[model samples]
Target chain A: MPRSVRVRLFATARLAVGRAVLPWPVPEHGLRARELVAALEQAYPRLAPTLRGSRFLRNDRYLRDLDETLRPGDEFAVHPPYGGG
Target chain B: MAVRLTRRPLTLAEAERRLRARPGGAVVVFAGRVRRDRRRGSSVVALEYEVDRVPALARLRALERAARRRFGASELVLWHRLGRVRVGEVAVVVGATCPHRVEAFDAARYLIDELKTTVPIWKEERGRPVRRPPRRRARPGVRSAGSGRAP
Candidate 1:
């Protein structure tokens, strides 16, 4: 109910974070994608490596770069390098 | 469908049927199957595949478009299976129909390679522990020849 970002993790990212989704609290004004990533890395050191190789998505849309801002209630997804055949 | 991600089995017949949608002189179909491999002394029995549905489907559609634009593919089928897939079972199939063989082959190859790196899908291996031979028991008679205490 409170202002928070729903962070989705998959594959190695999910393994590291031990969850498929995390409710990350953020400022009402929104947070820079870069800063949010930094905070996630700081919070879950094990997920740092995966974060470095992952692509970010906000509301199911790919983020061109980390410069994009993520607002409250947004769904942020972390996609690791794909291994599908 | 030109692009799809489903749990159902992928077959060449299905791919061929899809490729029949439009007329083309040449067709190329590629199927990838799970392999029975030993990992860390365990025999892999199956693979559990997972996918981020929306993104994965989006990428597949993008690949389909690229194939059509680059290779002039008249028909295409890109299908991948999710959930448990046993060794030797088809896991994915990508095919293309072009005016000639060269383009068909090239397009099929591109579709598969790009799908591997672009699609949001991953597979986890499931293995069965290796069985070890039973230890032989020594014969219980005659004080055991060479029992070191006092020969």
Candidate 2:
């Protein structure tokens, strides 16, 4: 069974993804950062296009690559470029 | 002293009174209001501003630190509105108090300026006159017009 993780969305991310929080089922080995992105893209079709070239943050730190394993209880957020001045 | 984020309209008197109670010699405040125009060339019948509280609060806290360090203010209060805001509604208010006028004024200005570029917010124009996002190549850099959502 895949580890279940909580995905939290905020601001533009919430608007695009259409929810404030989501439960993600990851593989037993755990989902890597990149794999999470692909899963998110699959889950939210409307957000998939926007996710292209967007950035990801695990907790507060920015994730540059997907090799990091997803931890249970971990909160992930997808951040679009901040457009505010 | 207090950093507040709400969708309801802000009260200038409340902000001023709170700052004055802190024994500061000077208090400076900046309020951003919704206007009649939007980036997409929309007539801006109305606006809805949206904010993600988790990251938004984090960013605000960082700004408070920066304001205190750069302007030497005694206290700072930053309040922002998130949700649909009608035209002419108050969207944000940042108040800074200090022992001198210089620190008060500088801190207030710096806080607003930095927030415009740093915060993660979104704005959606509604009703009429749809406006398009500005071309990235446009000169004179446009500030991100925040979402119309109110808290």
The prediction achieving the highest lDDT against the true structure is 1
> Number of clashing residue pairs in every model?
0, 25
True interface contacts reproduced, per candidate: 0.82, 0.50
lDDT at B106, model 1: 96
- The collision pairs in model 1 are none
lDDT of 2 by residue, B37-125 (tens): 65655577667766666777888899998888887777887887777878888878888998899889988988887777667666766
Interface DockQ of each model: 0.81, 0.40
Docking class of 1: high
Residue-wise lDDT of candidate 1 within B1-151, one digit each (tens)? 8888888888999898889778999989999999988758899999988998998888888888889999999999999999999999999999999999999999999999998988899988898998979855666774555656873
Task: Please state the error at residue A25 of candidate 1 in Å.
Answer: 0.4
lDDT of 1 by residue, A13-77 (tens): 99998999999998867898999999999999999999999998988789998998887878999
TM-score of 1: 0.89
Where does model 1 exceed 4 Å of error? B132-151
In order of appearance, the predictions have TM-scores of 0.89, 0.73
